[model samples]
Target: MSLPPITSIHNPKIQRVRALLGRRSEREEQSAYVVEGVRLLEEAAAAHLHPQLLLYTPDLAPRAQQLVHTFQKAGVECLPLAPALFASVAGTESPQGLLAVLPLPASQLPSQPNFVVIADNLRDPGNLGTLLRTSAAAGAQALLLSPGCADAFSPKVVRSAMGAHFRLPMWAAAWDEIAAWIHQHSLSVFLADANLGQPYWQVNLRPPLALVIGSEAEGPGPQSAALATGYLSIPMPGGVESLNAAVAAGILLFEVARQRAAA
Candidate 1:
């Protein structure tokens, strides 16, 4: 049972997906985001996230066809689009001929999380995504994005995160909410700073701690800095100045994991 392909670019579904990919406002309005490629689709399935809509071309590879069939049988709204049309709206250079519009999962901090990551004023989608991925891998229980941070659900960030969005508890929040949450959890909050802070390794990262990484350009703002329980800096003996925001986060997060593993 083959479905008719969507050949017109003006089709409402096509237009909607294009809008979701191109505009942050549209994504927020619809409470959905677009994800492309087979690997991502597989990750979504593993995380048990059912897509609101699945679009693929008839030329999909054998494995992709199987996935489409699986979703279709599971009552997902699976549709076919012309290959060129998919390419026109796709963010990647090479289209895998599969994409989905998945609803944004509800994000909340865990009741008793031991570790959390706060990305303050992070502007780069690549860095934000890497931070999300690294935080998840390092076993942080939640992630918080400051008001000015990049859209975590943006296509670039989603793609780079490699499905961390589905697995990690994360959301954007204001400084006040962040401060309240930190205090409520009784977690020590450490701001990552290049200057005027104790060495990261010297700080106690055992558990129940929150690590904050600010923008590469401005670092954490005054409001965010004021909320920190302490400031931490990585020792760069080579005098390289500072690590990329994501790299610093990865180093500090894993150190927390390492300390807890031994405890």
Candidate 2:
């Protein structure tokens, strides 16, 4: 039998989850983050990343209850929370009746990574999340976030990423660290820009490369530019100035995939 449900919103575990959901620092401090609903946890399980703790409501559906039982069987602490208390802590307007605290995935770049995505000062959670999703789909070996970028494990990002966090190797690094990694790997760094440099489709993306995507507002940072072996541009004949960061990333990343496939 499972332990009794927690009734207080101020319960220590509940408070911790709230802090993790609300603040990046709290997550960094604990080396953990919260994921809402059943889907994320399912992805986490698929990635072999298990949650440390799970909180759910008494009225949870049977399918979701089964999910809770799976975690319970795995030795994860499963706690029940009163509906009102769960509502108080849930990040979504309509609580999914399931929340889990999962450790931050400690993923490292594979040896001889031929493809990586570098996000330069991207602050929008949705954009960053989409980039993570696209990178995983496009077969990038890792993702590097530059300074001033939004926290990769932030709740909004985790939700928007649709479980990419469970699978992608992502790290937030200083520019110097990013540069050193590029050199160590001998990767050809290509910064994506709206204007300047060779058109992206024309470039031979089959080589071992790191693609740098910049913030939509300020473009690439000086440090980012300093690290670039070259720049890439997507041709916009419609006379548009630029594209959404995620859209640009999707287009560029798929192009990389296409080139490698045809090669």
Candidate 3:
């Protein structure tokens, strides 16, 4: 089935896609987010997610064209846009000529979750995304983002995460909610602190544990800190005061993975 090309910027679908990509609130209200690039579109399909809308341009790569056809066969609404118009809303400097509007996955806690990561007030989207990727790689069952963290579904986050969003169960909630969930699940919580804490390797990172990583500027807030069963620190033998939030999280999460694997 052939669809009309959308050349006008004022087209409702174009406007909505732009809004979703630009604003977190809009994404929340619409229950949708935008994914771009051939790799992400392929990832979305591999994850068994159907896009509510798929947009492409004449310049779309052959691989992307085939994916578009696949979506079309699956009864997805696929449309074409003029290349210039498509680039206008694209997040990357070099547009890929393909994008999709996908429903936000439910933010439920994973069933039988064993390892989890809690991010507290992380403002950097790249950092948060990398953390998600690391957590997924380390076999974390879920992630919790405290208030003030960057929107997990933002374009930069989704891009940096490299499809972790589709695989990882994640939720954003307030401190009270996070604390409640932690206690209810009976999961031990460890806060990553640069100043004072047991070395990460020395800490037991068995299943049913949650690691809390804080913002770059400030460590975990007082409320979050108070909820911790213990604290962990990475040794800085090179005289470095601290590691980047994402790097620290990767190290801690993998340490947990290493222990679990050995056991």
Candidate 4:
């Protein structure tokens, strides 16, 4: 099939990409997102997530051209746009002139998973994404998202995740549903908080565990607060209030990985 030419800035597809970059509602309505730059598109393709449509500048990055050809042979809609038009739709100040509207993964978390990371409404994209990267590194089975967290698919979150969005099973749930799953799995729910309970290293994380991190500003929501079996803290010997949420989560997740490895 001949690839369709996107010659005009007013093209509906171009308009859609612009809207997706600017507004969350457009992404929600279309079940699409603006994944820009060569890195993201390359990783998405490596994960076998063929995009519904691959849009790039007429001049493609040399490293990305092979992947573009692969998509074309796979029958995905792959083509280029005007450099000026592509730049207007790209998110970053320095545009890579490459992007795609890939479908979201269909994998859901197991009803009672043995190992998991529960994000209890993390508000910061960078924090949430770092948690995801940490979880993947620590060999956690999946990432379970509770209410009030940033959209897992948002461009900021995706960029911060550093390829984790394609690597792990990520799912969303209500607090009650997550709570019920915790109880059903006999999983120990550990909440990481700045001021509370035992130091994180003292906690036994080898068993089926759902390690929960909370919002950056307010910490965990009331539902998560009430549901925590116990709270764990990391000592700040330097008189700091606390580490950033992602830093804290990375420390705690590695702790869990350490305990399991030792056991």
Give all TM-scores, in the order shown: 0.97, 0.97, 0.97, 0.93
- lDDT per model vs. reference: 0.90, 0.90, 0.90, 0.82
**In model 3, what lDDT does residue 140 have?**
89
Tell me model 1's lDDT, rounded to 2 decimals. Answer: 0.90
Which tens-of-lDDT digit does each residue in 134-214 have in candidate 3? 999988889999999999999999999999999999999888988988888888989999987889888778858889999
Q: Model 4: runs farther than 4 Å from truth?
A: 1-5
> Per-residue lDDT tens digits of candidate 1, residues 99-126?
9999988887799967899999999999
On lDDT, the stronger of 1 and 4 is: 1
Angstrom error of the Cα, residue 185, model 3: value is 1.2
Better model by TM-score: candidate 1 vs candidate 4: 1
With a 3 Å backbone cut-off (N, CA, C), the pairs that clash in candidate 4 are: none
Summing lDDT over every window of 10 consecutive residues in candidate 2, give the lowest-scoring window: 1-10
What TM-score should be assigned to candidate 3? 0.97
